[model samples]
Target: MKKLKKINFLAFALLVLTTLTSCKVGRFIVYNFADIKDYEKFPARKIETGPTKFHFSTTTKGKVPEELTVKDKKYPFEKYLADHKTVAFMIIQNDTIQYERYWQKYNEASIVPSFSMAKSITSILIGCAIDDKLIKSVNEPITNYIPELKKSGFDKVTIEHVLQMTSGIKFNEGYKNPFGDVATFYYGTNLRKAVSKMTLKVEPGKQFEYVSGNTQLLGMVLAKALKDKTVSSYLEEKIWKPLGMEFDASWSLDRKKDGMEKTFCCVNARARDFAKIGRLYLNKGKWEGKQIVSEDWVTQSTKIDTSNGSAWYYQYQWWLPTKTGDFMAKGILGQYIYVNPKKNLIIVRLGKSKDKVDWPELLANLGQTY
Candidate 1:
């Protein structure tokens, strides 16, 4: 009887665990990418899957640059990996595999979540729509496609404004507590409605505030703009395949069955593919003899714009590292894809997602050395 009761209790516990996790994950789908509205400004598009794995035992550990001497010689870069409880995968230049090491049991095969970093990729696809003339202009109101947002504070927001985090329309965005607006968006049900109903806290385009709502809004715009097509499809055709990514990638969708993609952050890819995006920028949007993203677009999107002259600012979706041309796509925790066009380098580091603030200085140290 004791044995039978123990087995039953264990079964019950496992069932409970599975239920809670599913509910937590499904919260995102219920709110943001729910299937109800129908709008398509651009022609229909679909997602194209990209490469995900290597054929051999390849590691980026070999590409440590010869010039990687840091300000402190006491800090052995090699030893840093063994000491810090973090995960990192690095690629230098577009084609070179260098210095990929992981801790906390993570490696290239780990399909880790991409926090907000996926927004960078989403913005790239938006730019493609603009280039293809599917989008009339960033200046054109997204409302021209999705009219539901017109009466809301979003009426005044432009695609350009949203891309740069300058959209003044209000959404509380820091992740401090479960009661906060941003936190509620993540944890609460009906995330799309909750976000859409959020009142604009400030005037549009006058200030800089980071909000996941901005990216979510961008996804809604993209969904409406690309009629009958998945953003994934468009991205694969334009960015993924053209860049020669090495493995298949996955986008965590809001609703898996209905194909609602998590526009803000849903990408899962290998470190090499992340490096390819960086390399794409390093090469100024050219890949494999094709001009995927325009050099002019890369320049204008990454150039410092509002709020800061030195600490670096965002342009389009890319973060300017300095007044120089170096740019980065950073996500929650320590996810980074750093690109320097002048140096002909692209570096990627994917790690545990909840420890970014604890190690910004350390990350900066690595960034500077690269």
Candidate 2:
């Protein structure tokens, strides 16, 4: 009877494993949490880099301090980053590399998933689409491109509303809940279907609510605007290639075949290329005398604005940490591309987890020293 009980337990365990692997929420349960390495788990479309590469001027004696203090306690700088699960960190100022470091066996070439930083990139793409005339304007109702959402009363929602995360879409942003809306979008194989079923929780343009759904909706709109071109290809053509990224990166998709990009997150790239994104915005969307995106769009994205229920700290998918013209592209797992145009500075940090650090504040403080 003891042996039979053991066999039954084994069978039950197998069943649980099967269940966890088969369903959408179960995939969330299996993965447990998001990670910098998450790109490995998903299928992706490559954002191919151009033959012309842009390299930051490097120096052996970078000005970064070797130690940092927190809550009146001091720790070695590298130790602090490692303790915080950081894998890659870089500092750039005056168009030169100030400091670059790696931990956890990660290096310059290691790919780190951008997490929500992709939101900022999505915002850039939207701006580019507008500039290219593929998109009429942000004021236009998103229903112009995605009319299917009209059935859900999304006709009143503007692209600007989604860009500001004030769309009032009924979305659960909690990552801890396996059955939540974000989990379904993050782990489910059908992003288009998931987005199509989205309904409004409240009227759009009423309040500021930070949710990933808004960005995904923007992705859908972009897909429709681009028509035959995939969003990834558009990104490659417009940003990646023009930026002269040193390495090829990819945007993770929801499935392996004709899959929609998980544009609410998941841009997998190296530290340098990620830094270039910051550089782009730092120069007001210009790259090497070429206008990659309009300076007006960059101003609109990073400037302080609180109108129409929009939060002052966020606009056009970029976080304005302070009113001093500083902005950042932040990800869930401690990933960041912090840009301070006032100081001509950019800091890139990628980690397995945030480790409870107020990174924007830290990076901003670091900027003051430069």
Candidate 3:
């Protein structure tokens, strides 16, 4: 029986390797985990975006070891790490890398799209804009700067309201069959133009309405405040490098003109470097000795506000789960930077999930096991 079990294990391992290498799924490569460094992959930082000439961290510091089993799961997390569509999965606890694994397809150099997760990343950048004195306050009416907004209902909306998804913009959260305003705005017309033309259906900040329209509106505000500089440039100067992130992340554009980077979604990054972002939040926007995010921003941004039966709520584009001592930067279809400061944990899970897959339970369960 022991001999038979060993044979089956070996055969399964071989099958996995063969499938990953042979499977051709769009831009993804499955079987190149061992030789990940050799896959001719896309650049982590696109030069057109003005990133400070790409810096590669040749030596991975505090590298997480491979093959940690997920306790009490139908399928082990290690198997998910090995075969899931995700390019990378990293878990750090006690400020040490506990588990780090890359798929056969992706490596340190390849970039994974953040999708809707980009909104949370933009939230931090907006914090930086405030810290740098480019923006006076989150409460300032957005129309104060953009005269065109004065005639519309958005004139009453503040940056804080936008960030918290409580802007109360009349929007439907439906995405599956996206004939609605938010969907048409995102998937149909030019994003910036679509948002600029939005007519308010309700008062601002009355209730939470998971609308991307507000974030896109805020993106236009960032463009105005940054002196017409590019999103990538401001991010590079303020947030990206200061965080000690080793790779360059790309942002999706609002239009073919490409200068207006979409804030509600579409930022791509490496798995480990994305973990660095979780670590940055873990350390409260500080890297090494200096403070990158003001203590106030981190405190206020993660605070639970507008509760929904104590499940979770949005604050400054960050998600606050009901469990105290835990806040996360989560994106649609399961891109997470789950940080538990109390437990000294930072986790990154990047993937391509065509269908919904529950991961919060996966991490919450880890809290008990580890």
Q: Which candidate number would show the highest lDDT if scored against the true structure?
A: 2
- Rate residue 348 of model 1 by lDDT: 73
Among all windows of 10 consecutive residues in model 1, the one with the lowest summed lDDT is 35-44
Instruction: Please report the TM-score between candidate 3 and the true structure.
Output: 0.77
TM-scores of all predicted structures: 0.80, 0.94, 0.77
Go through the candidates in order and give each one's C-alpha lDDT.
0.64, 0.92, 0.65
Candidates sorted by TM-score, best first: 2, 1, 3
Query: Highest TM-score: which candidate?
Result: 2
Error of 2 at 335 (Å): 0.2
The C-alpha stretches of model 1 lying farther than 4 A from their native spots are 1-73, 184-191, 307-312, 353-370
Q: For candidate 2, lDDT tens digit of each residue in 35-122?
A: 7668988889998999999999998878877787676677898889888889999989999898899998889999999999999999
Model 1 root mean square deviation, Cα atoms: 6.5
The lDDT, on a scale of 0 to 1, for candidate 1 is 0.64
- Report how far off residue 333 is in candidate 2 (Å): 0.6
lDDT of 3 by residue, 19-100 (tens): 6433223113342211223112222224132333323223356543333344443664566555556656777776566666
